[model samples]
Target: MVDQSAPLPSVCDLAIWEPVLRLTPEDGTERGAGRSARVAGRISPSGYSIAHRGSMPSTARIAVQDIQRELARGGVREVVFRAEVRPDGLTTLGLVWPSPAVEPAYGSVNLGVLVLADGSLPAPWLRRPDPVPGAVPAPSADPELLERTLRERLPDAVGATEEEIAAAEARLGVTLSDELRVLYRVAGGDWADDVETAIRVDKAVGCEIFGVEHLFGIDAASRFPGWDLGATDAIRTPPDAVVQGLAGSPGWIGFGTNGGDVFAVDLTPGPRGHFGQIVLLGHTESLGAEPVADSLTDFVLGRLREERPDRRGAELPAVAGVGTGRLASVQAAAHPALEVLSLDGGDGPPFHLAPVAGLPRLRTLTAMPGALADPLEVAGLTALEFLALGVQEWRVLLDAGAVPRTLKAAAVTVRHQDHLPVVPVANEILALWDRPRIAQTLLEGDLGPAAAPA
Candidate 1:
């Protein structure tokens, strides 16, 4: 007999116990050889009570089925039994095994079950409480430093007041992003200093910030040819009305220019469109626009600190009667790394180009509507590989036998007034070489067969 009052050991402290049903005849027959004794006991949380007749089966499966049937009658959904061998050669039964559905107990505090020495079972253990989740914080934006930087750089800069900016937003029918609004309030659309004039025109052509006048007003649409501001219903005729209208409705708001090139704010948002971004459009029609800066403030700050080419050291020898002396001086000072030179005689009087020594890297030369009396002046440039000139100068060089031997390619352009067929001239140049690489440009009409294969 076991003591029932001695404070039962915690469920975790107790060893697993298996209950066995032994049979004995009423007439004092040997225990396992005769009729079996009926077993009656609860299966803890399963509330099962076993009651069997006759002799207990030697097979483990028969015994397990007996236990399962008893568990099912007590409303238990599942039952797992383990058989333990006793000294009498009979197997004892153990209740519920550890599984995913059964949560582990916390030491002695909530061990899932208690088995008595006599195989009587107690109540099941309680479960642990679930944990609470944590809260996530929001992101923060930059402070007033960005706006302060813009003010410090452009001291004479004029910024749009809150009312003016709001009015513009109302008129444009689009909400300006926080970054853009901050930019307008710090520095509106203009620089008081000679910012445009200070930019190097020759080095950075077709890329300059616009003045206040070009930035504001309903007539601003006129500054950008082929651009239709239909969103604002502001359209104006371009100076050269012959050019076709630009493709696609204007998706950007124009703010600056590099000569004829445009810089604008991209308003469309998507994978391809960088909304609230600034972009630079190249002067060449073939080149597509490119993103320059993330915002207007960044673009302006970059321009203010941009470095111009150093032109103070160089000097060109004065050549009397040749009107190119000043032009040569300016060109030398402006482009120190120039390898290709393009000149237009229409910009000034006809001038003789003196052989500019020390230009060891000069290779390609293009002259438009110019009277180059002696093409031999450039014969000394051993590196010269390509030459482009007006039809008159090309003919002059062909007659004088002064075309440089180093020349591998040559292009000719025919003016509208010359009324010369481009093919004939192109063929003449091609005839000069057994395998000539030639290109021709027609100022007005098309260059039929003479057009170079792309």
Candidate 2:
């Protein structure tokens, strides 16, 4: 039998192979190269199984023990980890931390090293580094408009004067987030977007910003990996799956507004505040100036300041901006079946449709007064769910003037609309989505037009 100690063969001699791996904690120290060691498995570096002509030698067994010891050192613990194999058959090491509070998705990670039977090393074990506490994913290139908006436009409006804040409060009915209030009070909103397309705190706050009272939102990709953050039109890009952001950095976000625009901020007092990418709520035709943009910013800034240093929280004012009224009106016309959606100017389509077509869920959708002029694209959603459609947003009822076979519970309502002319093709529309029966049974009569002009 070949003596195991007889100088081990090079990695080229093994018929099957397996990789050597390393694991580290969230804030673990950088591992040294001496950590590398070999195992007893007589395998190749590129494969998982191993074989040999004779029994394993004492030296090989000892090497495996040493490797295991190094892997489990410090805060790093050893555990079985799997990676999604690519077409090329190569695998990348995924690092996972022990805490359920961090990188929970990757509960355990396979270290990064390919060990040879002879104790030779293929490469250094690698792992992902933690991101800056409040880093916001920014476009590789600077977004000129976003920069100007954050730095110049917002600062100028915010710094106007105390009179400005008072006037804004009167105009827009709602109070602002504490962070926004601080900005308005301190720099008077005079600021610059130092991070180009992305936003970050000028400094880091030692405390976590997740649940600061009156602070409202503090979203991080590390916290919510599933968040979608591509420019509306950039949905096809791969990075959209792993973009980072503050809680309200735009895109479609749920602030627990419970179907309203009212959102909260992080209650924790920190320097990071809510500095991150956010889709500007206004700035487009999505919604008319129901809420004055200036006032909303002030209210939010004031709220932010009150929470800083040491200050008492104030009662949020009962204010209704234009956004609320517009949303309310839009909701009135919203029908679960035929919904009209609006996209923030900068935000693209709804995330649910990303893998499908590219459209964000619209906050306000008004339904048409009568027969659908065009067929609606709603493959992403299953039937029976409610869809909101805005007025004047025509949808094709069918192709080739034919109705759909599946639409039964769909209904249409018009918000902020009154005294419209009768629909010209209500009967034809009923025949399209195969809704004639629904029209007669559910609609309760003729697929007739509204008595007034639409």
Candidate 3:
């Protein structure tokens, strides 16, 4: 019998070992039983905890049994078990398997076996770093100078009154971070050009900050009716899969848009929720609400200093000002190593695809639906591996063999007013792929993959 009076061992005290499935002759005889499955474990203050990743109830039970048998075989004794009911009503069993070989040291004992009982695992398991507390930004050397510089650099800079700021907070249901509130009081919300650009904080991760009009509660009036502000849908990721953040959340309050992309702040506070932190709700090829910055101040300052055009190579100047005219002048001075590029023409004008012919190392290109109308222009991009184009352009590219043979994947966006026949176009694209490929099509509101031909 175990001593119930003694405190439980901490996870750090144990030599955490992954649970590997071991199949004996008897286990092998069981239908659907295969070689051992490896379940990763994390260290907590109490003990090491292992959670089933999307395993079915039946499968989870088997895994737990396998782990217990393996431990017993290893000479662990006096194992205790407990079942925990999750909020969703699923029962997850927790085990306390002790290792007698390893003696206790530093007031900590060996935590041989432990399992997560109730709550979901922390988001850090997805490899997202914990939010580092950021210091308040001071753009210039002097505080007064920083204010003056901000006013001069940011066109249409206006300060909000204390009463106005308070009102906005009350309506939003979350207190704005002090640094962000100061920004609103100093420079107001909108910028002059209103050019939407992503502030890259991590690789393939960025935050798209919109113009001033979307700031504060300005967009609430213009928000789409389908946009739900209270939905807290957890992201569906495979157990062992690593991603940025959750996908759907009612806690996300939209503040701006980057083209069709929505940028919002997570108001819900907890392990998964970055309460008061700015998050980029997935809008394009990527999915999930990726936490961009610790606060609005971090995002704005990071955008101004780090994501500036000058910092990024001049090979792609079109990113600085995203317009059809700006894109036309973006010529690669040499055989540039530009891999990913997104061209947004907005409502201004259509982008000229002539400059892209110079990029020999271009891999992925995401542009306005109408930008790739002329398939011949992009056919010469032999290095192009992935392309995001409209359904009409997919037809044109397929018919003309304009899609590079090097292209391994593609995504087509179907517009609301698009009346073009999709079945034939989808068929043609599928026929062109000789090997295994990934082909996705964005229909009306769904950004899922279109079924491939058998």
Give per-model TM-scores.
Answer: 0.26, 0.18, 0.27
The digit string of per-residue lDDT tens for model 1 on 392-444 reads 77677777877766654455543322323333454566566543222222111
lDDT (Cα, tens digit) per residue for candidate 2, span 1-454 = 1112211222111111122221111111112221211121211122222122334455544444543444444333432222221222222322112211111112112111111111111001011122435533223212333233345433433333666655544543334433344343433432344343112221121111111122222222222221011101001101221222222222222122212233332222123322222222222212101111122233222222222211111111111111222333222323432222332211222212222222232211213333222335444333212222222332343334322232222223333222121121332333343332111110111111212212
Q: Which stretches of candidate 2 lie over 4 Å from their true place?
A: 1-132, 135-365, 370-373, 376-411, 414-454
Compared with the true structure, what per-residue lDDT tens digits does model 3 show for residues 1-454? 2222222332111112212121111322221232222222322323323333343345544544554454445544333232222222222223333322211111121121111111112211122223324323223223344354455555444566777677767766556655445555665543344333122211112344433234542122122111111011112322222222343334455665555767665554224333456665445322244555555544554542222111112434212233554533335322354545566656655555666675765555656566553656776566665565676677677777676666544445434313224333543554565322212121111111222223
Q: Looking at candidate 2, what is the lDDT of residue 102?
A: 15
Error of 1 at 385 (Å): 42
Candidate 3 matches the true fold with a TM-score of 0.27
TM-score (C-alpha) between model 1 and the true structure: 0.26
Q: How big is the positional error of residue 219 in model 1, measured in Å on the Cα after superposition?
A: 13
Alpha-carbon error at 305 in model 1, in Å?
16
Clashes of each: 8, 85, 4
